[model samples]
Target: MLAVSRSVTRARIAARLPIVERTTAGRPTPTRTTKERTMPQHPKGSVLEFDLRGTGSGVLQEVAIAGSEHAVRAEGHPAFGGTDSAPSPLDLVLSAYVSCNQVTATIVALGQGITLGAFEGRVQAELDNSVLVFGAEGDGTFQRLTLTVDLETELDDAAFDAFVAEVARRCPLTQLFERAGVEITNAWTNRALARV
Candidate 1:
């Protein structure tokens, strides 16, 4: 019995394990630890919870986050029997993606002691709505996504590329979309920062 228990423990230790860490936004992320370990170690991290409340009526939906007074509204297109008063769900998602990238970039720049100015981003996505409209037997996710970012900074081309790579690697939304099998294309343009 002691030998069997030791063998099981050794096998478990040889397997790859995930280490959960917290991001600056208080979100938990699973990352790969060392390749080999001697013993199992537990993480002493606190979990953060985010709650959202939403109300929908006639193709119009309003959502509010917990502990926040601000709310956002979304509506379907007029062709979909909606009043078209607000942006569609996909539009909101794209907006969030773009903003999240910018936010991540800012955080990375601050950590690296880099200065930035006049940042802008544009995103386009190709999606098939047949699954939602006709209940087709296919995925309803975006087929392809392209994001272009324009930043005014003093960093050289090589440094700019490295910075963008780091931002993409650290951005949670980018990770989520890529893991979901979305084909993403990102282009970054750097310009000289204006001197005051």
Candidate 2:
């Protein structure tokens, strides 16, 4: 230990000592200054949640939806009747297929660096039943969707056809809906234990 007297104790040091500073042969020590990896935190997540209620059917659920500009649901069905005038699940689904086609077309156009002036899709869904009755099985269903696209970006016919081809390939719900397979598994709940 070095000698320390009463004078050294009373004298104030000119500089503070660094904690365990190492001085290797010639290379300087590495330091992390202002390079810390920090990611920005989102203040809030998405603000959409559809409230689903049981429609008391085999595989049907009533969704009380929001995010519409208006304030009343289209039909006043007690289950799907929201404060706003929007369509029901089936209606929304029909519209979703049409809307999805439009969106997919836009994405396809952007990927190919083309510009679409106007795009509109019209869809008609038929139950094919003689009459509308509650829980009546369909005779056979048929649907037709017509899409009209206007071009202002001056793309050729082949390019436009390619865009439509991509839309037909991609659009999701319709392309996979017919060919999709589903598996249902039955499980008992806590309350079902009593009955069992």
| Off by more than 4 A, model 1 | 1-48
Residues 26-83 of candidate 2: C-alpha lDDT, one tens digit per residue = 5543332246323334433212223232343433344432233333224332343443
* Model 2 CA deviation exceeding 4 Å by range: 1-86, 130-143, 148-152, 177-196
RMSD of each: 14.1, 27.4
Location of the lowest summed lDDT over 10 successive residues in candidate 2: 187-196
Clashing pairs in 2: 71-83, 71-84, 72-84, 72-85, 73-84, 73-85, 73-86
Best by lDDT: 1
My TM-score estimates for the predictions, one after another, are 0.74, 0.44
What TM-score would candidate 1 get against the native? 0.74
